[model samples]
Target chain A: MQNTPHTPSPETSKQLPELFQLLQPHLKALDAFLETQISEFEPEIRDHVAYSMDTGGKRIRPSLIFFSGWNSEGEIDPNLVKLAAVVETVHLATLVHDDIMDEADIRRNRATVAKKYNNATAVLLGDALFSHAVYLATQFPTTEVCRDIAISMRQVCTGEIMQTMQRGDPNLDMETYFRVIDLKTAELFRVACHLGARLAGFEDDYVKAAGAFGRHLGIAYQIYDDMTDLFSSEEKIGKTLGTDIATGKPTMPLILMRDRLPENEAKALRDTLAGNIEADVPYWLEKLREMGIFEEVRQAIFDEIHKGRNAIRPFQNNPSAAHLHTISELLWNQVAAL
Target chain B: MQNTPHTPSPETSKQLPELFQLLQPHLKALDAFLETQISEFEPEIRDHVAYSMDTGGKRIRPSLIFFSGWNSEGEIDPNLVKLAAVVETVHLATLVHDDIMDEADIRRNRATVAKKYNNATAVLLGDALFSHAVYLATQFPTTEVCRDIAISMRQVCTGEIMQTMQRGDPNLDMETYFRVIDLKTAELFRVACHLGARLAGFEDDYVKAAGAFGRHLGIAYQIYDDMTDLFSSEEKIGKTLGTDIATGKPTMPLILMRDRLPENEAKALRDTLAGNIEADVPYWLEKLREMGIFEEVRQAIFDEIHKGRNAIRPFQNNPSAAHLHTISELLWNQVAAL
Candidate 1:
């Protein structure tokens, strides 16, 4: 399997449906919007924030916001572009703090905000970005958009707090893991679609369908990400791999592996993870592979992707919906390739 | 002179003005509103947020929001109650993070949130509170109120980031000090009044004047706080003192002391401060007193209070406006007694 970056370019996206070409122009516009959105009076903050913005990743969340707003009739509101920028800023803010919490040195093939600057700077930058994003949301004429952003952010914080509390707990159950991912990842995706459809003045049913599509897409995306953490190399992933293991954070693969094994075998894996043997990554990697956990996790990812595909099945005939369907497919393919 | 807590109770507030008595009912309502606002799916978060809210301080910002909305004809919008709650939540969020940054053990005669909980919990709590507050702001029908809250939060972050960047610099000038306070402190205060007046549909001049009032009041309040840090004891203040000195974070007293002393003497003070003689707090305290820096700082506080009073002078003819005027007078009197 070739380890290609998941981030898509105009040329790469050309292989997808015609909707990809439409998305290209909007993604370019989002790039333009994001470039100027980070300016601050403080020179250092301005530069650091700009640096974080410039080291961009796959703009999946913003794409959801744009594509959700693009209905079958091919109508798009200009305001959805700003909403995309706002949601992307929120994502960036979370990444800044997430890096600090994980002590991650690299992200998107560059030093993280915490590593490049300092923890305090990174924390404050995250707060600044959050406030700026809220400011941008309020720039919209309707309170509904701003309200959705705030609620999504609240849910994000709640999920992070729950995840933080569950750290080092080897016995963290599957239910709690699902809840955490739902809040932390799926909530943002849900809100992206919610904001896009709502701002486009779609009916409540369409808006809800859009949200459902994003929620499943996001869940599958996160599950796929967990698989990559277990299977991918640092060179391929461009991040500090195995942090979830090192930090004793219970993710899908570990939970599934422990649950499937015999009681004694599960206990051994748990002890190895909970202990300080995490520095010897290859040993655990070999054990996990020998246990066939990656194969099981790949199946789990496919299961989620199936659910994700089913979520947007109603919108399949809408033409523009193909773009969203392609998103889930591309994410699964990216993970499967790794 | 006698030491008194600046956080007034119903009994103490009754001694000042009839307006305080009117504010009492609203403050109680806000207290009730806050009790229900901290709800999260995670029980630990709900409990921690409630605990932070339980350890109450001077509700000065909420009072500003309430009083600024008190029109001359005795009109008050019920929705302003929610706005007051929103502003107070933002203040609490900042306090939670501020305690972490300062490594403060106590606040409001109780363990600080970071001390009671861990730093991770404290950080997430602050973020949660911020998101909740913004969500509350968006509950308003118009976007103006939400936009004001967002802008105010941005300025607050800007000030904090600037302060964090400038940490351990002994030679921070008065201009920079003023700028930091104006952003970090006065901006929120200004917005509380701005939100209140705007929501109440006050005339443009009245809204502008109300903002000016809160700005000056906040500056005076912060300057008075800086003075107490230099002059008050830990027992009297009910919190850790001399953190600014210990952390080498430049404040008003150090700036004033340096400016007043001869070149060699100023250099010596800076060296003593910039070095790790923070444990010898009494020695620095004695030197500052001998140089009459406390007196100078008190005078500066008075100047700010005077400006604050002048800001609401035109409104004084209104019966409700005298309440705001009395606020500045009482604050000055409180500082003078100290």
Candidate 2:
């Protein structure tokens, strides 16, 4: 069912500006880490890849990875940073390929690899990232961590597949949507914390705690993404938003909103989506807003952030705890922005 | 430049046939091993993946892996067998995906995954197989082995990217072609043998020996494939074999054949390839046969096998020594079939 979008409170939004500042250095480290890993292959591979990667994004994934690792509270090795970068690269891989699968033309306010270099290059680049992620996965000290990371990869791929399958299916259920997001987006967040805990030599409960933290956070973040695209306009949101709705993505907000509609009105929304609308996005955009999906998803985002923050309660006292707190707060701040 | 088609022959191919056949049982055992390792996940994951895996192929990659483990004379753990099967699965992952990339309709006399289900299903199935392999990889006795196998995954993907880049480009060099094949097709073979030796408690020298054997054999196999695709009809080859000639792939036999062609004739062959002249397949086929490419590549296959056999001489006394011979026999037999 549709949940309303989470609009940010002015106070929370201002509070996390410092978190973005904190992420700047981590982003730099991540950029270098990414370059070095790609460099292991011929330079051309990295250059082609880095060109697309250099486009700016929020870098939320790496930040999550960092929080997970740094919170482990033991001697952190350079390997953790690499692993953090690995998490980001894996995300980048999914983004690059996902752009192609979705036939998306714009990402991060610029032409996607598929748009810039052509689909073949985008496909190859996506493959390279997948390859390189696995390549970089080896540096961890134990095979257990590496294996943990590897398992997460399957989840990511499976999630993407599920998303693709449900893509234009108006009848797509809410439960399947959550399962897809958990596997596709949240699993990495879960694994990132788990690996971070293991690398820090944290014991069993700590690992579980980190995993739960990342999983919930990731789910919250994705839900927020779904919410924003439906509720916010490009100018107001400060980016090109709402393509998900136009593409028949049947995101949570729309699902919830549709549930509240009269049967005829609901069927109209499905029919609109079933047309597989892509062009003149604003036309479909107006339809969804009229259908009350925007408010519904917005509220859902708020609830998710509330739940996500709750998941990290167990790790509050740990040294890396602040970063974890900051990451979640930054997410909450996004909801507050909505 | 275009080169004429030349089929490889078993009499002149690299590895031994009987050994490849012997490794078949081991390969089957490895598949069984994957089943055991896969059990912790939901049964749906394994059974869905098994749908494609159980259909099977010649078991080329795992055979190399089993021999690699055997090469070291280490205790045979079912783990190594499982590892070998997973490697084969990785190769399968590439094949299924590559078929999609190439828009191929068939693989091994059966409809390809993409053809059988659809692009979406095939992509997911390939990913599922990949993830399943990674999941099974966790069961290996050592993390080090896992790391090595993971690296092999990178090589496969990179090889694929490199090969894709070369597609439809007549300017691709023999050196570039070889490099692509080594990465795309041969790296797995190298790992197959290297893993065998490493698992069996073999030292660095043994690792090197097996690596050497796999590399040479893989190269020969690749070259043999090139030649057969050019010379054999699709009906006889059991696949739509002429993409190399069709897409202007600069494979070895073509490169060598081009060298032997007169300026005008070479120009004409290049013309046919650039045109993807399916109707004139016989015209190019005749041209390749007349240019003595059959003899040149046949000689090259003999050299690769000679080299492959020679590299394994140090392990001649190992229990898997017959395995190495069988691999060489299998390879040569493939050439002989051509």
Candidate 3:
């Protein structure tokens, strides 16, 4: 099995969505700004800092920040650029630590910090990255940016801790699952949009709406990600399928399947999830397909995306809202295609 | 050998120094303040946060802050209390992460967070604590507190990373050792004193001097800690001795001993540090005593303490400076007792 779930890197323009073309200059400034931050770290760990910062993920959170703070002048706001770097750096730091916990060797087609260095170095490096992110957040004029970023970071770790504790538990409920995703993934998304809009001098009402839009969109994105772990083919996703089941992570599809199966079958699946029995990935995959869990999970994703769209509907006249809607449309298209 | 070196917990009045008696109300305020922080964590992980924060170690950093910001009015400054909590929390967070890297089962006379829960939980808990610390730092009106704290946190992690990389390396020099300790240990101490004095509205020159005092005092304290890991007895220190040798961590005494040994003996010591052979800890310990390395290392610590005293000597008329001198004297007494 592949080490990590595959996600297309945003290195090439083709891999990015069409809306990203508008963010070309913003992202360019972000990349340059991030490059300058390597020197901010101590000389010894600068190489590791640079390596982790070069993750090349799709930068979805940065996109949220930029779009929510979009200006009519078409000029990059250095403050927004700094905010993007802060959020992206925090995301990258989480990824570094996550790789250690998952014991995964590969990330973005390169050796993870845990694999390249060691777990100890990976842990400390992740910490250094986190500290640097907060340091960047403190550069803002007011305490709001750092305060929001810090709270979001705490929530993100709390979500991850909850997930780790529930890893092999077969009875993780749907509500708990949603709560975890909200804290871990959506919290940062909410903060990015909220802070970006606030920093851009948006009206209070519009900023609140943007944050709600981001929260719902984040939920939708995580559901889609979890769905791909089970439903997508190795060829389609460029990574191994059924990893969520293999690793005994009770995601939406598996949770739904477990509840729908016969008592005997459900007991067997529970044993598999609890690691009392060897994981039969093919059997579970076949069972999920036969039970039509895929369509059910897809609907859940659509529902979240719809709710996200409804959040910003009242502010359609705002340019920032329009840009945010465009980003959501890109996600909608991806989900519909799947 | 025991899993970790022991430091006295400041739970008892007798265990504390004469000055801490004066700060009883201040320490009580810090405890109450820290207790309030527990609810700030997510409900799911509050127990773990509480567990890690109940370390009961000598709150040296907090003491530094309180002393550096001492007021003649004898009223506890809430800002100084918040600052103390921030630095102390950062210290505890580092200890949690350090326990994981050391794989030590015990810290401050209890199961470490890594041992009590798991490495993954410990990692995330440390992260949560760090975020909370920064969040508290942001509560101050200006960004200076958060900014200095973030930078110090980064340097602390950088120091740990360097030390981790240098593990089992036989050729680590004195200069690198000092550099690592300065980054890992002294940076926070320096920041605590600097910020404390600045927040108390002291003269700029005195603030700088206080920070210098803290830096030298931190150097002295770490040297004393490393000495305890090798020279002190399990009964005396209440944990273990010679762990540095067992763990292949080269400290001042070990380094001095290694360099002073005859060529063949030095090669064997180097090999032991490189983990090519079993560490004959008793032989090394006896050799350390025979060669008078204890006195040599002790002298190094005394030199740093003297330097710290000199840094504050010019500010003798100030109450804060006098308090800082008394703290240095406590360290001098501990070393003298050893």
Q: Regarding TM-score, does 1 or 2 come out ahead? A: 1
Candidate 3 or 1, higher lDDT: 3
* lDDT comparing candidate 1 with the true structure: 0.77
Kindly list the per-residue Cα lDDT of model 1 for residues A1-338, writing each as its tens digit.
Answer: 12133333222222455656778778888888888776643553678679778766888888898877875655445697899989999999888878877778988778998899877777777887888899899888779888888888988888898988888787889988988888989999989987787887777877787788788778878888777787888887766677677778788888987788899877766776676444455666777889888877777666665665555565555543566666665776676687
- Where in model 2 is the C-alpha error above 4 Å? A1-15, A71-77, A118-121, A237-242, A276-296, B1-24, B35-48, B71-76, B240-242, B276-279
lDDT of 2 by residue, B227-318 (tens): 87877767777666556676766788777766668888777666655664443656666777887778778778778777766777665566
Residue B269, model 1, lDDT? 68
**Tens-digit lDDT track of model 3 for A1-338:** 11111232121122235567778899899999999999988999989988888888898999899999988765799989999999999999999999999999999899999999999999999999999999999889999999999999999999999999999999999999999999999999999999999999999999999999899999999989998888776898888988888788999899999999999999999999998999999999999999988888887877786677677777766778878877876776687677
TM-score of 3: 0.94
How high is the lDDT of residue A84 in model 3? Answer: 97
Instruction: Find the number of clashing residue pairs for candidate 1.
Output: 0
What DockQ class does candidate 2 belong to?
Answer: acceptable
Sorting all predicted structures by TM-score, with the top scorer first, yields: 3, 1, 2
What is the TM-score of each predicted model, taking all chains together?
A: 0.90, 0.88, 0.94
User: What alpha-carbon RMSD in Å does predicted model 3 have with respect to the real structure?
Assistant: 6.1
Task: Indicate whether candidate 1 or candidate 2 has the larger DockQ.
Answer: 1
lDDT of 3 at A188: 94
DockQ scores of the candidates:
0.60, 0.41, 0.81
Worst 10 residues of 2 chain A by lDDT: A2-11
- Backbone clash pairs for candidate 1 read none
**Ten contiguous residues minimizing lDDT sum, candidate 3 chain A:** A1-10
